[model samples]
Target: MTTSAKRLDSAARRAQLLDVADRVFTAHGVHAPLDLIVEMAGVGRATLYRQFPDRHMLLLALMERSAQWLATRARRLAHRDDAFFRLLDYMASRIVRSPALSDYWRTTRMSDPRFSDVYQEVLNAFAPPVARAQRAGLLHADVRADDIPLLASMLAAGLRGETDAERRQLVGRALCIVQRGLTPSAPGGCLPGTVNDLS
Candidate 1:
């Protein structure tokens, strides 16, 4: 081990494992062998196990990392008029790179306690921006904060593409459609006349 590697404490080691695992899972799917993760991280199987008792546990850690990322990003975009849309752009970038993680999230039982916690984090991240957009007449009356997850799920449809470039193109197209639907129409435009924010 390098001198720096030797210096990593338990928490640091756990984080390092997750970082490596993120790349491995993105390339190999969540079912990729834990042994490979250990090998790539230059850590023993026991050490990996010490940080994550099992694959599910490790997956949960990754989910937490995702939620943390969303929260941090949401905070950063809080002040923008288009914060909600901007946050979605950031989310698409992450999801595109981490298809395996998002796939795992989608397949997991909705009732799972851990799943609920992570999903709630996602909801919380968008709530402020969603409300602001609605209050500002930026979003349609039918759009609600709870609807954000549905939009996110719709974005995941882009994941079907085999290539990263193809996936990005698909996500971009989907976002354009979604943003149009959520946005209030022009005067006498589609749906009822646009509700001007005027604030």
Candidate 2:
């Protein structure tokens, strides 16, 4: 075959492997065997190794992909008046639907230095909308930028219902309750705790 065609095929195979790896990793956690990924991708061991030299590299790629997805969505909503809350809902929905991914995130520690860059990317994307919401008095002034993800996690916990319909209802109710608490209070009144006080 032609060199150009071979290159195109290689690129396609690489992307296919990444997609398969994403699903497998999310479903099986980071420690999942590469053999499962290779099997699911329908690719040879050599091809999987060529695309991702190790499991760590594959996990990093998945994190990058998820970060990029959030960044893109954040950018699209940045101009809206309620972008902060909208973005929160977007992330919460993702967590509720992707149980494995959510479990992985919950199990992983954010303080790990290797994930700092990924964390920063998400924080940067969230910062502007958060600032805008605070300025407009839509979100509580006491709510710092970092609190958004934690809040989403809290709200998404309601998704542990038995059925999808039940989970959807629970998520909606949880968001409503949290959003109400997030709304600005009367003058001289704020949320019960400062941003640093999670307890």
Candidate 3:
């Protein structure tokens, strides 16, 4: 065990690596060197390896962390009628800050079974809020549960930005466009009685 690993318990050390990996993956894209994660995390290669056997493991852990955060955000906004919109804002903020994370995420196709848990977690977290928003007439009735991921992918196009400010600007614009299209009263919300179950 490394000196740092010896100092922290297993759970603490694991969490430390994850937090460091999150920032490193944000700054450098997902393919950033593992040695850099070790250097920034102040842990030995063995330590990081012990916590995350490979880059994919680390990346999936980050995705799971994100799902948990969204779940928490949903719970926090449980009392608000605008919970769904607030959740969209929250996701947009994350995408703006760490658009680089989208690099690896894009590679993980939805058909890949490895991503099912994270995908399911997303559905579990957002489905109800989406339904509530539609029922309240805040969103178009044509918008279905699966549409959330598709909408998020559209928003995440901001990841193409060359710089942080550019990313924020692009994501902001994307969010505005998305919000307009999703709003029930908006012109582009949907066609009358048309539904897109995406089946």
Candidate that would win on TM-score: 3
> TM-score of model 2 relative to the true fold?
0.77
- Per-residue lDDT tens digits for candidate 1, residues 23-141, read 99989999999999999999899999988999999999999998898999989989876788777777777767788988787677647887788888888998889888777888776
lDDT of the candidates, in the order given? 0.79, 0.73, 0.79
Judged by whole-model lDDT over C-alpha atoms, candidate 2 comes out at 0.73
Looking at model 2, the pairs that clash are: none
Which one wins by TM-score: 2 or 3?
Answer: 3
Error of 3 at 143 (Å): 1.0
1 or 2, greater by TM-score: 1
lDDT of 3 by residue, 56-155 (tens): 8999988888889999999888777667877877787878766666656655787889999898888788888888888788888888767767878988
Mind giving the per-residue lDDT tens digits that candidate 2 earns over 30-122? 678899988898778998888788977777766777778889999998888688877777675765555556556655667988777887888
TM-score of 3: 0.87
TM-score of every candidate relative to the true structure = 0.86, 0.77, 0.87
Ten residues in sequence with the least summed lDDT for candidate 2:
190-199
lDDT of 2 at 171: 66
Q: What order do you get sorting by TM-score, best first?
A: 3, 1, 2
